[model samples]
Every structure is written in C-alpha cells, then in structure tokens.
Target: MDAANLEFIIQMLEQDTDLKEKIKDQVTEFDKKTRTMAGLLNKIHSTPTAQLPPLLDSVQPILASCTDITAVIAQLVPANQFWRWKDMWCNSLRSAVFSATLIEYLRSGTLLTLPQVGGILGIHPEWADRFTLAAEDYLHGLISLVNELSRLAVNSVTLGNYEEPLRISAFVKDLFAGFAMLNLKNDLLRRRYDSLKYDIKKIEEVVYDVSLRKLAPTPAK
Candidate 1:
C-alpha cells in the first residue's frame, strides 16, 4: 500500500501491542494474588473445621484486592473488545472464582452464586456486555472446587474429622445435581462435569466408611 497507509497500520499495531502488554502485566499481578489465596485456602484440608472461619477470613483482603486489578484491566480493554483479550485474564479470573467459591463453601457450606463470585472478584457476572465473568469460566471454577473437595474429603478422614467428610459429600452431591441440569456445550466443561460423578463417589465412599465404623456422629432424630 501507500507509505501513509503503511505507517498508519504500523502505529495501530504498536498501540495494540502496548495495550496487550499492559493487560498482561495486570493479569500477572492478578494471578499472583489468586495463587496466594489458593495457598491459604489449601490449608482447609489439614485445618480443623472449627478453625476454618479464621483461615477463610484471612483471605478476604487478598480477594478484595483482585477487584482493583480487574478494574484496571477492564479499563485497558477497549469497549466491545472484551472477548478479543479475554484469554489474557480468563484463566486467572477462573482461578480467582474458584478461590472465592471454595472460601464461601468452607465458611458457610453453601455454593457461591455467579453474582456472588462476581461481587467477590469485582466484575460483572454474565449479564454485562463487557468485562463479565463468562459462564464457562464460572463452570470451570466450580469443577475445580469439586476436585479440591474430593481431596479434602479424604484428608478430613485422616484428620479424624469424619463429620466434615459427610458435609462435603452432601455439598458435592448437591453441586453435581445442579450441574446435571445444564446443557453444557463446551467440551472441556462437559468433560469436567462428567468427572463430578467420580468426586461424588469418592466422597460417598468416605462417608460410608465413616458411618460403617461409627466414627461419624449419629444424626439427631
């Protein structure tokens, strides 16, 4: 093309590159915070259930910081171009969602809704036209939570927290039931959903063993 056209194209490419670099830097920071939260949450497997509230509470500041980074990334993204650059932060966002969901579950034994997770991460949840948490990412985080809970089930038994395994079993089965209602089109999400059955089975086996041995406390009639 003409010299002016070629120069304009070059400038546009440079701007895009600059924007991408900035987004990547913010995403790196976000990922670091997410990993820190994950590490703290991992303690749940070894921690007594009575002490879990403090551990869950300690991660609140770290989780809250994610909102600020997300806002900066949202600003860097051009309007209507969220999908174009989503790959830069989608995985990190999903990891953050997992941490939030896991913390909520540990704290209250309830699943965090999409809006709740969005609130925790300081982003829109599936409704906003821009900078929203994709449904696929949210589903992926839930699957990760299932996997972690399975591990926690096994560890709870080791820690002599037999009741915790039963609680995890019930919670995971409820989650599996919820997932079964979705007509998931994403192959990865579908596969992960399929794996939920195995987690449920692992947790059930833990519960069964505890019940059979009378290690778990008997429920009040």
Candidate 2:
C-alpha cells in the first residue's frame, strides 16, 4: 500500500475518539452509581451502631444496582479501547469493593478478600488482573478499604462496640502483612502502603485502650 493508504489504515485502526466518548459516558454511569453507593456507605458509617444493620440492609439493593451498572459498563466498553478505559473504571471498581466490604464488616466484621470484591463488581475474580492499571495494580483498592476500617475502628468504640474494633485490628494487620510480601513498584501504591503503618497503629491504639480499660470481651479460659 502507498504511504497515504498506510497512514489512513493506522488512523482508522488507532484513532477512536468517538468510541472513547461512548465509553466515557458509560463510565460516567458507573461513577454515578458507585458514588451513590459511597454516599450510602457514609451514612452507614455515621449511623448509631444499633442502626447500622437497617442502614446496611437498605443499601443492599443500591449496591446490587451499582454492581449491575458496573456489569453494563463492562459490556459497553468497546473492545478497541478496552485497555484505554481501564484507568477510568478504577475508581468505580474501588468503590464497589468498598461497598461490599462495608456490608461484610457490618454483618460479620470480616475482611472481604480480593476474590469476593470481584463478586461485588459482578465479575469473576480472574478479571481483577485484567483491569490492573500499569502504574498501580487493582489490589491497591484494598488500601482504601483498610483506610475506612481504621476510621471504623475508632467510630465503633464511640458507638459502644469494642468487638468490631478488635476484629478490624486483626483484619488490617493481616492485610498489611499480606501487602508486605509484595514488592510493589508503583509509587502511589508504595506510598499508600507506607501510610498503612500509621493506620495499623491507630487501630492498635484503639484496641489497646479498650483492653487496658477492661472493656474488651473476655476470652474463654
């Protein structure tokens, strides 16, 4: 082919502003849905501990709808720009995981693993690898979860629940240890990981205060 023809072919194959815009619109929907869920999460966190169960229950349908929106986004993304939009969807995915874990922590005070995060986003766990950004892997979202849990640890005590803080302390410490095993190359993730040290200390302090006061639940003899 002539040089002009070759250039035109490359442009046709590579230049995809129109599709990119459509994908952006879809991502905007995902963003909106996830943000709504985040708002509900804020409410859940702020609610009195006794009221948290009902708040969580009310948000369950909203979270499911957000996951549906995420699924729609995955289907709407054009194959040509799949990789191009990965970064755009990162926040939405992170929010979905946050919502999922918030529910789990409310119901059982359990740590939601990366695999379960996928289920929240309505995607299989394996897809987590595909969506990992070049600079920061998707697992960085776990740091966001840990961050919220730290705050929750403090709030749980104010709400008169010491057990949740203890559970959160154990979960955050375990998660931090797991992250330590990774040789993270991303500066953003590394910085986030470094900050986790302080968060872990904060939760530890909360647990320590409770134990020192003899307010913590007694262990079985």
Candidate 3:
C-alpha cells in the first residue's frame, strides 16, 4: 500500500511538468551535495568533525522531500474510500463505473469514453432511444434505494425511539448486504472482463418472493 501510494504520488508529480522540474531540481541539489561530501569524506576519513557537515546538509533536503511525500500520502487517505461511509460510496461509484465501462467495452468490442458509455446506457438525452428499457428500470431501482436510505436515516433521527432506531439499523445493514451483492456482481463483471475479452450482457435479475412468519418480538431489556 505504501509503495503504491508513493508510486502514485511520484506519477502525479511527474505528470505535472512544473512539479517535475522542481522535484528534479531538489534531487539534483541533493545528489551534488552528496557527491561533494563523499569526496571530502574520502580525504578526512578518520576526522569526525569533517564528516558531520556533509552528512547533515546532504540529509536535510532528502528528509524534507520525504516529509513532503508523507504529507501528500496522508492527505490522500481522507480522499481514499476506505475511511468513511461517504468515501465508501465513492468506491461504490467506481465499482459501478468500471462495471458499466466493462459492459460497453464488451458490447462495442472497443474502449468507449465515459460519455459514450453513459450514452449507450440510456443516460444521455440525445441517444435515449437507442438503449433498452432495462437501463431506465435499473436506474430507477438504484435511485429508489438511495431515497429509501435517506428517508430511513431522517426518520430514525427524528423518531428517537431506541427500538425503532435498532430496526432502522438492521434495515441499513441489510441495505449494505444488498450493496455487497452488487460488489460481488462487480467482481464477477471484472472476472468476465478478463476472461471473455468481449461484451457480454449480464442482467442483474433480483427476484422478490415475499414470505412472512409470525414470531414474538424481542422483549425490551
């Protein structure tokens, strides 16, 4: 993780031409100082005093560079999805985006731009007629789930009944479990992307078969 984080930072820095030049300048300075110190150290091999300045000066910029990189990595943590629920939703979005992208790649036998995928998926107003009814249906279900969760959170806070809140919590957990199913679907989509090497339409068909059982409610403690 640390290596990947560092690599990503370096990549980002390298991509920014101005930042790359600055980093290169610091690296050049550090290298020059290290070489100059090494030459001095060779002459005063046994002298502790001679070795100190080069060692200290040579290390300062490297330490500063590391500190800057560390700070950048620290900032990326809050931006990463593993930290918070809102951020986790970003993960969910990524999973969805990749899945949709995979689908488009499969169907078209070529990589499609995001707007193109959105268009193929019935999202764009101009190309709505080209897509299937299933696109609208799936989108509606997803929106409905989002609205339901929002409503539940609001009601749970407003009611302030402990039991009701617990029930809400259970419902939220089940909703997460449903999302887990979607994650699994995404994993499957990724695997298919790797293996099939083409677009395959995988319908997410959720069957609702209702069943009810009467049981005594848990007694309040």
User: Model-by-model lDDT, in order?
Assistant: 0.88, 0.74, 0.34
Candidate 1 per-residue lDDT over residues 1-221, each given as its tens digit = 99999999999999999998999899899989999999999898789878888998899999999999988887788888878888888899889989989988887899998888888788854425558888889989999999999999999888878898888887888888888899987687898899888888888888889999999897676
The best candidate by lDDT is 1
Instruction: Supply candidate 1's per-residue lDDT for 82.
Output: 77
Evaluate model 2: give its TM-score. Answer: 0.82
User: Over 4 Å off in model 1, which ranges?
Assistant: 124-127, 218-221
lDDT of 2 by residue, 6-33 (tens): 9998887665666567667876887787
Ranking by lDDT: 1, 2, 3
Q: What TM-score fits each model?
A: 0.94, 0.82, 0.20
lDDT of 3 at 142: 38
1 versus 3: better lDDT goes to: 1
RMSD to truth, every model: 1.7, 3.3, 24.7
lDDT, candidate 3, 98-193, per-residue tens: 333322322332434445534432343432222212232333233333333333333333333223323433443443444445433445333432
Top TM-score prediction, candidate number = 1
lDDT score of model 2? 0.74
